[model samples]
Target: MTLTEKLTTEFRQRCEGIATEKRSLLNIRAFEPLPADLLATQLGATILTPKQIPNLNPCVVAVLLDSDQWSAGIINQNPLWIVNNPRHTPARRESNLMHEFGHMLLKHKIVRFDPDTGFPLRRQSDEDEATYLGGCLQIPRRGLLWAVQCQMTQTEIAVHFNASQEMVQFRSNVTGVNI
Candidate 1:
């Protein structure tokens, strides 16, 4: 199913509310940028590269370090250890961490990987929800509107928010706020 089919209007608004609540907790204004690293710290989460994971197989680490396909994941829940791919751009790293944080905020259960494929058995709705929430966390609808009011271009907004231009455009498209 498509993302639109998985996520409802109320769910989207709830995600926006979650973003606002997180910002409030951090004492960040609606128009201000919320850095994912700062948020992770506030959440008592430790961000780690694959290499930082002790006892990890060297071959697995090599595969992870060499690839850009993977983003990030919460490897541990008690201490909230998130392993992110270091090969990604800074903006991508932020987005990746935010997506993982989205899953955390939503209390999504960790999905087991398929033994045959070695890929996580993700639920489409869960992924959709996390993706929507991640975008909201990166660029809240109110923040987008504020940027638009300030006459910021998509590129400028991306730079201001420390996000990729594509993310800014995606936020605009989803929120129906022309940038």
Candidate 2:
């Protein structure tokens, strides 16, 4: 099987596990936004803005590029403190927090920093897995299919899931469900 297929299968299983644990319907027509804050609390994590990080440099927060920035980072693995970018919209912030949660759930190790750039170095494979799983958590395949069956538009699905329009489009593309 192709790598994409393998990843999709695994992510689907993970989503199912989460749904079962949460006692949510697996075939939901309109996916309600997973409360990232609640999830963080359950996972012994706390979400905070970059500026809220104690003793964080103001220049560092100012220099973040909201468009392609590292949306969130799970600092302090023991206590699990997540730092999300404040510049993002609410929907985008939710996705960012979900992505961070993905990493935490997958037990990904703390990222190493590139000394030259003074930035955290990411593993492409890990990032891909987290992104895929995060999307699944936000909009599952069953949920997308249900939306299509219900004749929901991309925008409608985004609103229902509290996700960005671009996230909905991406889900449609990946799941091959026409909006």
List runs of model 1 lying over 4 Å from the truth: none
Cα lDDT of model 2 by residue, 85-144, tens digit: 877888988789878877877788888789999889998767877776677777877778
Candidate 1 structure quality by residue, lDDT tens digits, 149-174: 99998889999999998899888888
Best by TM-score: 1
Candidate 2 residue runs with Cα over 4 Å from true position: 1-8, 19-30, 65-68
> Worst 10-residue stretch by lDDT in candidate 1?
1-10
Structural similarity to truth (TM-score) of each candidate: 0.96, 0.82
**Cα lDDT, all candidates:** 0.91, 0.74
| Pairs in steric clash, model 2 | none
